[model samples]
Target: MAETLDILVIGGGINGTGIARDAAGRGLKVLLCEKADLAAATSSASSKLIHGGLRYLEYYEFGLVRKALIERETLLAAAPHIIKPMRFVLPHHRGLRPALLLRLGLFLYDHLGGRKVLPASKGLNLNRHPAGTPLKDEFTRGFEYSDCWVDDARLVVLNALDARERGAEILTRTTCAGARRNGGIWDVELQQADGSRKTYKTRALVNAAGPWVADVLNQVSPHSAKNKRMRLIKGSHIIVDKLFDGDHAYIFQNADGRIIFAIPYQDHFTLIGTTDVAYQGDLDTVSASDEETRYICAAASDYFKRAVVPADVRGTYSGVRPLYDDGSEDAASVTRDYVLNLDTADGAAPLLSVFGGKITTYRKLAEHVMSELQPLLGFSLKPWTARMALPGGDIPNADFDGFCGEMSTRYAWLPQPLLMRLLQAYGTRVDRLLGKAADTADLGEDFGGGLYEAELTYLKDTEWATCAEDVLWRRSKLGLHLPAAAHKKVADWFAKATEIAA
Candidate 1:
C-alpha cells in the first residue's frame, strides 16, 4: 500500500516551499518534491528586491503594487537578517518622466500599503547628496524611497527549512514523474536521483513548478486543464566591479522607458540587471545573451558617470519567468499578479496550479493557497505564518543589528568578517553551525573564502546540500570569492563524504 499524504507539492522554488511550510504548519501531512536543488531556477535569479514594483505603477497595477508593498514590511519583519531595508535613488531625467509625475508615483508608492517601519520617499538634490557622486553631472535632482534587499536563494531555503522542521518532507533531486487521480486521491509517482521510483497517494496536488508549470500540467498530469498558457520571459543580470561607493542603489531610467538598477553587491561588486526578452529557448541552459548584455550595459551607461560595457562584466545569470499569459502584446506589460487555477470535478482530488508571482508576495500567496484548500482538506485554516519567524529569523523584536552585537560578544574568538557573513547567512542558527567551536581552528578545514568544514557539514546534514554547486552557488555565493583550487577541494570533499556514507 502506498503511503498517503494530505498534500503533495511539486516544485522546490519559493512558491512550492512556501506552500509546503504553510500546509505543514496547519498540521497537515505534506510532502514537497524538487527535481533539482531548491531555488536553482527563477527564484534565485531575481533582482533581489522586496518592492511594490514601482514600474508597474505606469501600467496602472495599483492593486498588485499595494499587495506587494504590504508584503514588503511583513517579510522584513519576518526575516530581518536576510532582508534589509534599502533606499533607492532614482535620478530625474528631463528626457523621461517629469519631476512632478515622479513625485506622484513615489507618493503613491509610499502610502499604498499604509507606510510604516520604512521612511517615506523624499526629493533629493543629487548634486549635494552622496548618491550624486556616481551619476553623470547632468543629473541634478532625484528621489529616494525605501524598499528591501534580500538573499533570494536563502529566502527559498529558509522556507524549506521551516517546512522540514514543521514535519514536512522536502525531497530535493526528486522529480514528480506523473500524477493521476484515483477517485478522491492522487497517485503521485516520484523519481529519485538514483533512478529509484516510488508512488504515494495524495489528497491534493499543487503545481508550483515555476517555468515548468505548464509542462507539469500537460505532461505529468495529462488530464489537467489545458486552457491556461505561460509566457516565458527571460530576465538577465550582470555582476561587475563596484560601480559606486555608497550603500544606496540607483534606479536608472532609459529612453526606451524601461528601468535598470545598479546595486552594491557582495561588498566589492555592483549588480546590474534585467532585460525583458520574450524567450523561446531551452530553459535549463538559459544564459545572458550578448544582445541582452549590451542592452543592460547601455541602459546603465545612460545614468552612471562611468560607462558600463560588456568587457567589464564579471559574471552573468538568467532566468525564465513563467508568467500567466494574458494576451498582452508586450512582455513587460504582462501582469505580475498571480492566478490560481483550480481544476476538479465531483469532489475528486483537487489539482491547484500556481501561475505568475513575485518573491515579495510569496508568504501571502501561501496563505491564499491554504485558504483555497481549507474547506476541501478539513484542516484548521487559522493563519499562523504571518507572525511566526522562519527558522533562524527569530531575533528579539527582529533587531538584526542587536542580534549581531550579541553574537559578536558571544563568539569573540571568531573573525569579525566571518562572523558577520555567518550571521547574515544563517541568522540565529549560527550557534548551531558553530556548535562548541572556541576558535578558528575549531571550525575545521578552511576551504578558502572563509568556508569551513563545520559550515559545509551543517549544510549537508541539515540543508539537503548534495554537491559542490549546492554549497558554493545556491547555499552561498562563496564560489564568486573562493579561489579556483578551492572549488575542486570542495567537490572532492563532497565525493569522499558521499562515499563514506554509502
Candidate 2:
C-alpha cells in the first residue's frame, strides 16, 4: 500500500516548497512532488530581490507593499545568510518625476509597514554627495532606500530542506500523472524518478504549480474546479559586466512610469532587466528574445552614462509569471499579489490553487494558506515559521559580516574571494558541501568561476540535479561567467555521471 499524506502539493517552486514547510510544521504529514528539479522554473529566474516592489506603489497595491515591507525584516531575521540589505540609488531629473512627488512616495514607503532593521529612505544632493559619482551631470538630487537581496533558488531549496527536516517528504523529478478522489481521501498516482509508477492516498491536494497551475488542475486533479484564465506574462533579464564602481544599485524611472534596476552581481557583473511582455510561448521553453533584450538595453542605457547594447549582455534568462489576470491592458500593470482558490464541496476532497506570487511574499503566503486549510484539517496549529530559520540562514543577529569573519578564520588557507563565494553560496552549510576536504585540490573538478566539484557533488547527491543546466542555470549563475567551452565541460561531465549511474 502507498503511503498516505495529509497534504500532497504539486510543483517545487517557492510557493510549493514554502507551503509544504508550513503545512508539515503544523503536525500534518505532507508530500511535495516536483516534475523537474526544485526551483527549476520562475523561482530561479527572478530579479533576486526580497523587497517591497517600490514601483508597485503607482499601482496602489498598498496591502502588498505593507505585507512585503513587513516581510523585509521578517525574512531577513528568518534567513540572514542568503537575504541581506541592499541600497538603491535613484538619481533624479528636473523634467521627470518632480522631487516632491518622489519624496511623498518614499515617505510612504518608509512608514508603510513595520519598518525596523533596515534604514529609512533619505534624499541626497547628487551633485555634492558621493552616491552621485557615477551618474551624468544633468542628474542632481537622488534618493536611497533599503531592500533585501536573496539567493532565489536556494530559498526554494532551503524551504524544502527545512520541510524535510521537519518530517515532510519532498520528491523531485516526480510527476503527479493523475489524482482521483476516494471518499474523504485523494488517490494520487505519481510517476517516480526511476521510471516507476506508484499510488498515494492524500486527504487534501494543494496546487502550487506556478506557471503550470491550470494544466495540473485540468490534467492531474480528478475533481477539479473551473479557473478563470491565468495571464502568462513573461519577464526577461540580462547580466553584463559591472557598470558602476559602487556597491549600491541604481533604480531608474522610465518615461512610461515603469522602473529599471541595475544591481551589482557576483562581484564582477551587474544584473539588469526585465522587460514585461505578454507571452504565449511554452512555459518551459521561454527564452529572452532579441526584441526584449533591446527593450531592456534601451531602458538601462536611458539612465546610465554608459551605453548598453545586446553585445554587452553576458547572459540572459526569462520566466513567465502566471498572474491572476485582473484585466489589465498592459502586462506591466498586472498585479504581483497572489490569490487562493479553494474547491471544497459537501462530499469531496479539497483542492487549493495558488496564483501570482512574488519571491518576497512566499513565506507569508504559505502561512496564510495553512491558516485557510486549518478548518478543513481540523487542527489548532498556530503559525510558527516567522521566527524559524531556513537551513543555513541561522547567523548571529543575522550577522553575515560576523559569520564571514569567523569563517575566514576557520579557512585561513582558502583565498578570501573563494571563501566568500562558498560562504555566500552555501552559508553555514558549507561544511556539508566540503565534507572533510582540506584544500582547493581536494575538490573534484574546477569548472571555472570558482565552481568546484565538491559543490556539484553536493547538488547531485542532495538536491536532485540531474544535468548541468540544473547546476549552471538554476542552482548557480555560473552560466554567466563560464566560457562556452567550460560550460560544455559540465554538460559532458553530467552525461558521463548519468551513464555511470545507468
Q: Rate the local accuracy (lDDT) of all candidates.
A: 0.92, 0.87
Residue-wise C-alpha lDDT for candidate 1, range 241-331, written one tens digit per residue: 9989978898988887788989999999999988889998888899999999999999999888899999999999999999989898988
The TM-score measured for candidate 1 stands at 0.99
Model 1, poorest ten-residue lDDT window? Answer: 219-228
State the local distance difference test value for candidate 2. Answer: 0.87
Residue range 100-152, candidate 2, lDDT tens digits: 98898899899998798899899989889877766777888899999988889
CA deviation > 4 Å runs, candidate 2: 220-226
Residue 481's lDDT in candidate 1: 93
What are the clashing pairs of model 2? none
For model 1, how many clashes?
0
Q: Best-fitting candidate, measured by lDDT?
A: 1
Which candidate leads in TM-score? 1
Error of 2 at 453 (Å): 2.3
| lDDT, candidate 2, at 412 | 81
